[model samples]
Target: RRRGGGGGVETAADFARTAPRAGYLHKLGTNVRQYKRRFFVLRPSTHLYYFLGPNDAEPRGCIELDGGGVSAVRELETMPDGRFRFEISLGGDGGEGDAGGMDASFASANDDGGGGRDGGGPRRIVLEARSAECGREWIDSLRSESLPYVRAELESSRSEADELRARCAALEARVEEMRLVERDRDGAV
Candidate 1:
């Protein structure tokens, strides 16, 4: 398992070509609860990946911002040292613990000194940014990227609501027909 500084150094052009948001952030370890600096890259696909370093060929872990993988992203109160932080709450059925779909060795490495699972069910990952402005920018970028998933969900809900409304209308029409039949029967009697 690679530590913080094993990968190649990233150039400005690399950042420009790869992702809009790519930088170093201190991630709170799940088991140790200690903060470790990791290089994160937020992709256009709504996947936030953290590497041991900027040039790692494969990501140590990935957090899917769309598809119910992420529940929320919110800024946290500043630390006593004045560090701006944010939390990413993973959805219930999201990645495996704090490893975020990492392999066993990678997860174990993180568990020992890096990061790990907090507990059962949905979990949250806290990341500290270099500054308040940077923190807010990261949050905004994450929220914006995840909007597609939210829009898709909204579309689904609207379709369901339309179906329910149609069902209700049909039921009301059936009730009105039954009432008419009852009135005719009473007149005939």
Candidate 2:
């Protein structure tokens, strides 16, 4: 739940480094509406979703959560649906992520600024799991699955920043040395 520059810190895992989390859940079902059960694979490294249900051998829809693009996972208590519902708040410019599979969600992103990567707006993905325990497990798994990468990225960014600061200090010292030499020469002349 760290806040990033765009907003909250997102979990962008290195795709090649880790295994994806897979589960079966009911999606889009509200109190009144029926649910569609789908087998989803969440790749924390790329922050992409692979929705492959029992019927389809191949993934049906792929979504990219930018920068591993999730800020918060909260239950939608306000909604009338009695089902265990949670929403994944998306931050950063919504990227197509590298899903290989895109659907109406990808195509429609341009219309509502939902997937814009310009750091202008925010998007959300709401999912309703059949059970509350399952909902919690999903959240926990998602966070922990991305923990390694999050730590890795934080270290990488910190090191890069430190390196830049050191470089800047060296440049400043050189400037100071040049100024001293110029002053001494002027006095002598």
**Residue 76 alpha-carbon offset, candidate 2, angstroms:** 2.0
Q: How many backbone clashes does every candidate have?
A: 0, 6
Each model's C-alpha lDDT?
0.70, 0.55
lDDT of 2 by residue, 1-189 (tens): 232455633222221125456667655432334446656677664454534343342354444543545665677643345457776666555443344344444333221122222254455555667677777777776665554556877899999999999999999999999999999999999
TM-score result, candidate 2: 0.48
Which stretch of 10 consecutive residues in model 2 shows the poorest summed lDDT?
109-118
The root-mean-square deviation over C-alpha atoms between each candidate and the true structure, in angstroms, is 9.9, 13.3
Give candidate 2's error at residue 180 in angstroms.
Answer: 51
lDDT of 1 by residue, 67-89 (tens): 66788789987877778988888
Model 1 has an lDDT value of: 0.70
Error of 2 at 105 (Å): 14
